[model samples]
Target: MPLDRRQFFQASAALGASFALPAPLLAAEKGKERRIDLVSSAFTVALDPSGASRSAVWGFNEQLPGPTLRFRRGERVHLAVKNELPQETAVHWHGLRVPNAMDGVPGVTQHPIATGGRFDYRFELRDSGTFWYHPHQASFEQVPRGLYGALIVEEEKPPSVDRDEVWVLSDMKLDNQRQPVEDFGRILDIANDGRIGNQILVNGLVAGSQRTLTIRSGERLRLRLINAASARFFRLAIDGHEARIIAFDGQGVTPHPLPAGGLALGPGMRVDLIIDCMGSPGQSFPLRDLGRPPATPTVLGALTYSSQPALRSKPLASAVTLAPNRIAEPDLAKASDHYIIFQGGMRGSPVIGLVDGKPSRIQEIMAKQGLAWTMNYNAQHEHALMHEPLLHLRTGEHVMLHMINETDFLHPMHLHGHFFRVLAVDGKPTPHREWRDTVIMGPRQSIDVAFVADNPGEWMYHCHILDHAAGGMMGTIVVE
Candidate 1:
């Protein structure tokens, strides 16, 4: 269904609330012990190490990027979300298999959790891996303003590592006063990157050294990297260590053992990695970025080293065992190609953002009750007409996408409903091939991602920049 404007607002009004139950009680185990409470409210906090001024916005229980809710596979998980915001908010469980009503999508899967009201979300933990939760109402505004958290469903067994850390990355816009900047009207500029923020924060703090963990020279570390940003796409790297990507978007994959590459992460995307420390004892290994200029690359966190011990260590058990059900890959002749050009902004200055070829406006959005802003040139959200014919395939046919980034800025193109393989980047197959949900495309660069459209729905493909997406940089597909 297209985005329903009035319905969204109506749902928001109905679900807004304040206050939360106790945390320990929320997570207290019953029978076998399994429950959690995730708090949602506005906050005044800092993301950079300089510790900037506090701001106002929605957060989980007054905390930015709320609590990390962990559970074991096959267990019954209960979550009580207490909304403390002045406006309505609901938590959407991204990439989880549960009853539709527990999905936390306001006006869609379930009703919003009204202000001063509470909702009990109970579901069977059918799958285990990295997942996240965030508001779905006014998604452009709510999510960007800091309403997200990590939801890790641990497997009966887990991956081997000396330590496991969950990292959530986000961006923010603040005034000279260091307060969160709020201008709902300006956030919908079809002529510019919608909601592009000036400040970057990791785990709810700005780029600054916070905690230091001790690691040995040969110790294996696991990093669960999650992109919960409302708009920004991040390219992440760590200095002085070799890391291997073992999972994505919450599911384990065929382990492709390779050196760590720059992670192109988008909103709602997750990458699980195993790293072997090569630095000497007492040295610090910083998780740095080889990010391009204008997009600063800095240390998200650091790992301090301890003297190596003589005793051999045992690896943590694998989180998952069964292989994922993968669809066949498409060959060149058996696949189809499509072209999407992000057209907007003045030619020389690449700051202007556009979907397909048109600019979006609120008046335009309000005019269509069921229409949403499409990111590509297509007008109908997810139903844009292509310059070429739609790619047709059998029920289980393999499909390849040749996605080109025509603009100067970066775009983390995400495909909902299915994971695809990075077949080629700029005309070559990915060196160490792996399945990915979001592929980052820099200006003038192109990438080929293939997947079998097995699980059918109105899948979306667009830039992960929430601002760009809200301004009309999105489209959808339907499989019959």
Candidate 2:
């Protein structure tokens, strides 16, 4: 039977509602500054197929999901990491700018911190917002199982809020025995969409529950949402309350009212929203994801109002009209737009899809490298350039890159070391003027991103889905 559009939505909603859960973990307090000592050690934990439960690892601070390292912007950040894992490892301060040497890109900036090694990451917090850290080596595996955490850089002049909560949404793939499913870098790509799993989780639990909180009416609350899933894009919304979007990807932005409709969150993307609880005095407002299926409740969590005196008529603070960072806007008129098609399937069979007109052959490459993993239709092999695309631009030239999605799933396209503005969609002007480091492209859809290649380096442009990236959705752009 063909799936009706409405019926499809209903089925998806059912999948979403399969579970509702209580807030899974304890949240950190506002205005608290602390030091962190993280030890990345290798250990084994039990796993069902989905790899969702408390599995074994190689993790930071000896725990999966690593340790939550909290610090205030403008304050000194002291991170002492000790590695006990068998292999050498390095921590890349994803989305944070410290120093080139301290960037921790393993081969690029610093040497890998070997087993029983200790390294100190010391830097001044220049930005106040949400960020995270994970291994730079084998990041594809380390981050998927465990070894990642929230690196919240708090604002010096905190927002006028009574409380704040940080939520990291992720997914897992388990085997039939309910243990973490693993291909261990040998699975055929064409049979599945890279490393996507069957189980979905928010901060480490299945859906169909609630994360409850209490706040006085009229008080302001900040909700920081991070999509840490390896290969999922989230459409997040709060049930009854409206959330004003204040930032993206850790950079503060001009505010936009949300919960009027929810927002889309890509992997490596972050949104900070402020909600007022005094609207109905005692109403229960759940933060929902209208983007998901109806059967599956979109409620990320709930914000309950306490019986406090309502300030008759109080309005939330309007967005601050701050200029974007001091950077020159690129001239789009004279700039060139590049079109890159994301296409592939089984490795050696020569399926029709190719990135720029070249098929990715797993066995061919493995024969050259003496490896065992052969490419299936979707082998994550390198989709190299026949000739490097001319990407270098004048320091201030504005250029648009059109990404066309030809696959069955979503791809969170990300650019390293720089950010860009969304100029249009399918050739039409962008409805929302938001700047981002990563943009999620849906099947059959096209997106245009504008950016000035100001930061010069051999930076990577790839799918943020680590598995897809490993299979070959990876490339580099040189900014001269």
lDDT per residue for candidate 1 within 153-236, as digits (tens), equals 776668556667777777778888867777642533433445656766666666544445567766677778888877666677
- Compute the lDDT for candidate 2: 0.61
| CA lDDT of every candidate | 0.62, 0.61
The true-structure Cα RMSD of candidate 2 reads 10.4
Query: Which portions of model 1 show Cα errors greater than 4 Å?
Result: 1-34, 46-53, 97-114, 117-126, 184-190, 253-261, 294-296, 306-376, 380-408, 444-448, 454-461, 475-480
Q: Which 10-residue window in model 2 sums to the lowest lDDT?
A: 370-379
Best by lDDT: 1
Q: What is the clash count for each candidate, in the order shown?
A: 34, 53
Predicted structure 2, TM vs. truth: 0.75
